[model samples]
Target: MDANSPTSQYASLAAHCASAFALPVARALPEQPAAVTAPWCLTVLAADIETAQLEQLAAFVSADQWRPVALDILAARADCKVVRIQLEGDIAFAAARLALLELGQSLGVELVLQAGETQRAPKLACFDMDSTLIQAEVIDELAKIAGVGDQVAEITLSAMRGELDFQQSFRKRMGLLKGFTEASLAEIAPRIPIMPGAQRLLLALRALGCKSAILSGGFTYFANYLRDNHLAVDFVHANQLEFDGGALTGNVIDPIVDGARKALLLQEIAKALDLSLDQVIAVGDGANDLPMLSLGALGIAFHAKPKVRAEAPQAIDGFGLDAALYLFGLNDRAIAALLDERT
Candidate 1:
C-alpha cells in the first residue's frame, strides 16, 4: 500500500497508538468507530493550566490525527479550560481518550472527556442522594441522633468503601435505629444540609430541558423532601423506611434499592424518557454507586473515596457538584446566564 494511502493514514494513527499506549494496533482500531458521535472535549478542573502544560497537551493532540478545534475558558476562579478536538482521520477513539486521561492525571489535574453530543445537554441526570445531593448521609445522621452514631458510621464507611454488602449494611444500621421515633427523622430531615451547588446544578439542568431523578440507597422520606424543597428533580426512587406506631420498625420496605436497583432504575428512566443511555448522566460517591455510574453516559464520582475515585470514569474532588456542568461543555458565563434567566 502507498505510504500516503487511506490505509496508511490509519496505519500511522495505529502505530502512534502502539508506541503511546502499548496496545496492539489491530485491537486499537475497531471495525466501526467508537460511539463518540460528537467532537471530543477535554476539561481541566481544580487549577489553572500552566503554559507548559497546555503546550504538552497541544503536542499530544498533534501527535495523532486529531486537530484542536477550540479552547474555551470554562471557569475563571479555578482557571478551568475546555479544549475541543476533532479527528482528522480514522483512529481509535477510546484508546486516544485513555491516553489523554492518563496525561492529565500525571499533571495532578482533574480531567473529563465527553462525546460531542454531551455538550448539547443531557436528557436525564440521576444522582445518588447521600453524600452526593446532600452534605451528610441520611442514615448516618439518623443513627447519630439515635445515639448509635459510632457503630452505624463505621458500618456506613465500610459499605461506601466496598468492604461490605450494602443490603447487609443497611439492615444492620436500621437495627441500630430500631427505637428512634419518627419525630427524630423529621428533625433530621429538615436539618440535612443541601450540598453546595446542588441547587445550581439542578436549576441548570431544568433550564436545559433535562429531567432529573434521585436514585438513592437512602430513605424515601429524605429524597422526597429534597425533591420538593431543594432540587428541581422530576423523580425519586429510594428505599422506604418502615414505621410502626410513629416509631422506627428497624426494617426497610421489601425490595430495597441497592446497587443493582440503582442501575436498573437508570435504565428504566432512560427508556421512559425516550432517550438513549448516552443521553444520561449519573453521579455518586460510594461503592454502591458503581453500577449506576457505569450505566450512564457519563458517571462522576463527587468528592469520592479512593476506590470510587479511581474507578469512576470521571471525578470531582476539589470542586462542588456544579463543576459537573463543565463536563457537559458549559462555561461559567453560560451557567451564569442560565441562572439569570430565572427572573
Candidate 2:
C-alpha cells in the first residue's frame, strides 16, 4: 500500500491487509458484442484493496479484451468495500466465473459476476434453516442428548453433501431420537447459534421491502422459534416432529419438507406475496437446498459443501450472510443506512 494512494486510510484500518494484483482475466476474448445494449457487471466485495491493485484488476479486464466502460466505488469503508466494474464484450459466463473464483481466493474477497440486469432488489428472500439461518443442525443437538450424536452427525454430513438421499437419511436419524424428551429439545433450541450476520441481514432485507421466509428440512420447533424471534421473518415451513407423552415419537409428520417440498413452499410464498421467481433470492448450504436454490433469480449456496457450491448458480463462502447485500446491488454505505434506519 503506497502512502499516497487514495485507499491508504483503508490500508491502515485493515491490519496486515495484503496488496493483491492478479495476472489477468485468463481467458481468450470471447468476441465483440454482437447486439448487446447492456454491459455485464462484476461486483467485487472485499475487506481491503489498495489503489494500485484496483488499477491492476481494471487492466486485467482490459487485457481480456473486454472494454471496462465504467467503474464505481459502491462503498469505501476501511473494513469493507464493494467495487463494480461494467464491461462491454461477450465474455463467457464460465470463463468470467472461473476468473471471479480465482480472484477471490487470491485476494481474500468475494465476487459476483452476472449480466448487468436491473433486478428489483429481491422482493422475496427464502432461506434454509439448519446451517443456513443458524450454525447448528437442530437434530444433531437433540441426538447429542439422546447419546447418538456421532451416528447422527455422520448421516447428516452425508445427506448434506448429497451422498445420501435426504428423506432416507432423515428418517434414520429421527429414529435415534425415540427417547429424547420435549423438555430436552426445548432447552437446546434457545441456545442454537444464529449464523453470523443473520439478524442484520434479515433486518436489512425487510427494510429493503423483501419478505423473508425459512424453508427448512429441519423440524418446526426451531424454525418457528427463529421466525418468532426475528420480526422481519414473514413465514416459516419445516418438517413437523410428532411427539407423545412429553417425549419424541421419532417420526416426522407427512409432507416432509424435503428438497421438492422446499421448492414448492418457495413458489407458494412468492405467489402469496404477489411476486415472481425473478424477484426472489434463495440461499442455503446443502443438497436439499438445490431444488429451491435453482428457482430464484439469485440462488446462492452460502458457505456450503463442495457439491452444493458447485451446483448452485452462485456461491459465497468468502463473507458472512450479509455479503448477500452486495449481490443485490447494495453498497456498504447503503446497507449501513438501511440497517441503521431499522434501529
After superposing candidate 1 on the true structure, give the runs of residues whose Cα lies further than 4 Å from its correct spot: 1-38, 60-66, 78-102, 157-163, 341-343
Indicate the worst ten consecutive residues by lDDT in candidate 2: 25-34
State the local distance difference test value for candidate 2: 0.74
Instruction: Quote each prediction's TM-score.
Output: 0.80, 0.83
Distance from true position, residue 48, model 2, in Å? 1.8
Candidate 1: worst 10 consecutive residues by lDDT? Answer: 27-36
Instruction: Please provide, for model 2 over 81-115, each residue's C-alpha lDDT reduced to its tens digit, 9 standing for 90 to 100.
Output: 66666677878876777676776666666767766
Measured by TM-score, how close is model 2 to the native structure?
0.83
| TM-score, cand. 1 vs. native | 0.80
Segments of candidate 2 deviating more than 4 angstroms: 1-38, 51-56, 157-163, 341-343
Alpha-carbon lDDT, every model: 0.74, 0.74
Per-residue C-alpha lDDT of model 1 across residues 211-323, encoded as one tens digit per residue: 99999999899999998888899999999988899998888786889989999999999998899998999999988898998877788889898778767777787778988
Q: Which has the greatest TM-score?
A: 2
